[model samples]
Target: MLTAQATSTAVSATDIAISLGLLVAVYAVLGLLWLFLVVREISHGPAPAPAGVVEEETLPLPSAGPLLRPAGGPMAGSGR
Candidate 1:
């Protein structure tokens, strides 16, 4: 009876090990599939530049306001 019980326990342990092995294999296959999809996306082309490549001379900006006020204030046209 003792030997039979030991044999049954060994078979149960082997079954558990096989189940765990199959689970690991399934997860590995899923991970590989995800990696292949991500690689396919990155293999298309180069990404856009972080800084713009346009020249400032080609597109001049507007000038800022002058230091003096307009010619219609309380101190305007008085020459003071």
Candidate 2:
């Protein structure tokens, strides 16, 4: 009876250890896959601009028209 009990305990321990090892291996594989994907993305250059999307050569600034007024209104002899 004593020998049988000892054998059962050893088998249970081994099973638990194997289960933990398999869990670790699964997580390691997932981590490696994620690392590979990140590396691939870095190696590839930035994605191209969308089709038919136009980018301006230079940003347009507000024209110096009547919209630009000083704190004391238009300057003297500078046309209102």
Question: Which is the leading candidate under lDDT?
Answer: 2
**How well is each residue in 16-78 modelled by candidate 2, as lDDT tens digits?**
889999999999999999999999999997797798866565557567756566556665456
Per-model lDDT: 0.75, 0.78
Alpha-carbon RMSD of each model: 17.1, 13.8
TM-score of 2: 0.49
* Candidate 1 positional error at 14, Å: 1.1
TM-score of 1: 0.40
Candidate 1: where is the Cα deviation over 4 Å? 1-11, 45-80
